[model samples]
Target chain A: MVRRSREPVLWAMFSGGGMIAALLLPATVAVLWIAAPLGWVEAPSYEGLRLLFLHPIGRLSLFAVATLSFFHWAHRFRYTVYDGLQLYHLSQLIAILTYSIAVALTVIAGFVLVTTG
Target chain B: MAKALNAGYKRHYPKWHRERVPIFWWLRSASYVKFMFRELTSLFVAYAAGLLLVQAWVLGQGAAAHARLLNWLSHPAVVTWHVILLATLLFHTVTWLNLTPQALVLRLGRWRVPKTVVWAGHYAAWLVLSLVIVCLFVGVA
Candidate 1:
């Protein structure tokens, strides 16, 4: 019996993350980092943002984007180390480290999202 | 007799050797450099997500902490870094969306959707999503 490789699952997450990042990250970065800071757009007040996060939908969407983006980073960074650094000998270690970091961050993000208003 | 001869010949052959690819091989080609740049965008994507997590955590810490975060974000150096981050993110968005038509093939009954149309559809969706997010954050303030 052949043991299935988990590459497909990781690849699916990476693909989804890439799609989400593409569709969402631009405006997010623009608004949060650039426009709001530069006063080109009004920044969301602390109270306003907190109220937004208090809603289930906002928390869920934020969690989904952050989690998927991290997985995307893990998958891509795994390969970047493999091919870019030519560390094929340490492939298993790299895979474990990257995915573990993503999972750990996901847990932290989830905890914060759940506990916070 | 032929099998015996072939087996003996194989025993005398040297092991195959493959040349090691240099770590900076991608830098040698324009397209390879572009590919590496695209791959490197994952770092910024991860950074953005991590920043969001931090922001959420700060939000939970109370308004003083959140205000501190906002002040930090508004600093000249930090804003400069964000400008660079935004450029890389837009690059990621454009390259990722451009590749979508190739990855996803759309069909309507017997007719295949043109790649241009598929490509345009993704861009349209992206624009709408960007608008939605911008409104959610900016308009509400």
Candidate 2:
């Protein structure tokens, strides 16, 4: 029997992450970069944001976003190097390194979020 | 005899020259560059989320730590990077919204959802989600 490919699973996460990132990232950037520095809107208080993150929902949300976004980058960058840069010969190594980093970072995010408080 | 047969087959099926892709092939077309840039935005997206993870960690450390993190975020270099991230991510957002219809096709009974409706739906979701996050941060219920 032939082995089944895991590409679908990774692609699913990549596409899901892409959707969420596309929807939410711009607004988040607006608040952090544009609004806070320029005062287009009153900047968020550190304590207030902190308290928000203290909630379980907030922590989980951040973890989901961070992990998903990392996977998205890993998937896209993998293809970029494979096709865009034409490194098909290094496919196995590239996939291993890219996904390992994404998984590692995601684990770090989860650990930090859960244990920090 | 074998050599002669192989030579005849080679002549019958001429191999075409392969075109080499240049290092900067992406620069040759506007659309290719746009697509590559869109793919590149994934890195910025991940970076932003990583910053948030750091923020959550610092927030748990207490006010002093949180304050220090905020101070660091305000540095000139960090601010400049954030600015570039914002611009590129905005481009990512717009392109993503436009491409959603292509990715997801919804049909209601026999009728297909209009592409415009799909685009509008993405924007609407973005608006709602952004409002909720903003509200939560601003201490509004």
- Every model's DockQ: 0.76, 0.57
Predicted structure with the largest DockQ when compared to the true one: 1
Writing each residue's lDDT as its tens digit, candidate 2 over B1-141 gives 766767555535777796878767898899999889989989998988988888888888888997787777778787888889989888878888889889889999999999889989998998898887666655521
User: Candidate 1 - CAPRI tier?
Assistant: medium
Tens digit per residue, CA lDDT, model 1, A1-117: 999999999999999999999999889889988899899987888777876665688789889999999999999999998999999899999999999999998999899899885
The lDDT leader among the candidates is 1
TM-score of each: 0.92, 0.89
Model 1 chain B: worst 10 consecutive residues (lDDT sum) = B3-12
Q: Which residue pairs come into collision in candidate 1?
A: none
lDDT of 2 by residue, A1-117 (tens): 999999999998898888888887777777765667666667687767876776888888888889989999999999887778877789999999999999999889978987987
Clashing pairs in 2: none
Residues B11-36, model 1: lDDT tens digits? 35687797989989998999999999
- Which residues of candidate 1, in runs, are more than 4 Å off? B1-14
Chain B TM, per prediction: 0.88, 0.82
Best by TM-score: 1
